[model samples]
Target: MGIYGFDLLIAGLCLLFKQITQLSYVFSFILLFLSGSVIPFENLPEIVRKIGLMLPLTQGVLLGKKIVFEDLSMSAATGSSDFLWLVISSLVYLTLGVLGYKKCEKIAKEKGILSHY
Candidate 1:
């Protein structure tokens, strides 16, 4: 799941940037907020909470919280609907990341600038 998110992050950066410097700060903040790491998910505004729920990392964060605070067994936690959602989101990110990377490669090849950015 983490690998899927990391792949998506890398592919997104490749698609969006000609140079990657200074982009980490923005990505970090967005990831932190959307993943519910910076604040409790219940504390977020309604709309923001809804948005965060749709993101890939939110379920993982929630599962971790449950495991720690509620002492949920790994098997029990993974059997929940949240785990299903996490799997679905992982597949979505994996697909998007592969497509984005392919697109970026095509563009770079066409531009004849295949050297490292």
Candidate 2:
């Protein structure tokens, strides 16, 4: 998760994405926007919030807000409904995203997608 909740997990994902694309800058903007990294999840449209849940950052931001603004403790948050979603989403995003990135990297290398760059 982007939570940096686990430093190793985030570092692993960065490696996965870097392996798949040379467009980290562009991806940063997309992640920031779609993951609610820069905005509140509640403020997002219904469809977007749904999609945003597929990205780890959204859960991270939500959890962060709960800690900072709501004064929720780490242990308490881990027991809340929101934390349940965060855990579920983190599992889904990290597992699938890493595997998908590996597959894309293989295909992209075979196709020479970035050979010229």
Candidate 3:
């Protein structure tokens, strides 16, 4: 759900800022690295790890680890602050994505570029 929100946000941004499509690869690369897909979270530098902890993907990854490797039940694994963060972040991102897309859609319609975009 959080990842879907993030993708929706990016899609809306691309409609408003076409140039972003070109830079999205770089953005994805950075996101993957920060989310600990490329390296273990603990091995990351202190500052990077701190920043990563705030990202939605990081929360998902950590939660998944706890449920899988740690054999924790879903309720037990998600009972902590991490789950709260994930829910909050997901809602925030999803709301922002919908609002932004609506705004951009209006602008695109006004400019007569909605179809092309």
Q: State which candidate has the highest TM-score.
A: 1
Off by over 4 Å in 3: 17-20
Per-residue lDDT over 1-117 for candidate 1, one digit per residue giving the tens place of the 0 to 100 score: 644655565755665465764675667788789778999889989999888887778878898899999999999988998888888987787777677777777777777666656
Leading candidate by lDDT: 3
**Root mean square deviation (Cα) for candidate 3:** 2.0
Q: Is candidate 1 or candidate 3 better by TM-score?
A: 1
Q: C-alpha displacement of 4 in model 1, angstroms? A: 3.5
In model 2, the Cα lDDT at residue 45 comes to: 92
Tens digits of per-residue lDDT for model 3, 41-81: 88999999988887788888888888888888988767888
Worst 10 residues of 3 by lDDT: 108-117
Compared with the true structure, model 2 gives a TM-score of: 0.63
Ranking by lDDT: 3, 1, 2
- Model 3 residue 78 distance off true place after TM-score fit, in angstroms: 2.9
Q: Candidates' TM-scores?
A: 0.85, 0.63, 0.83
Q: Count of backbone clashes for each model?
A: 0, 0, 0
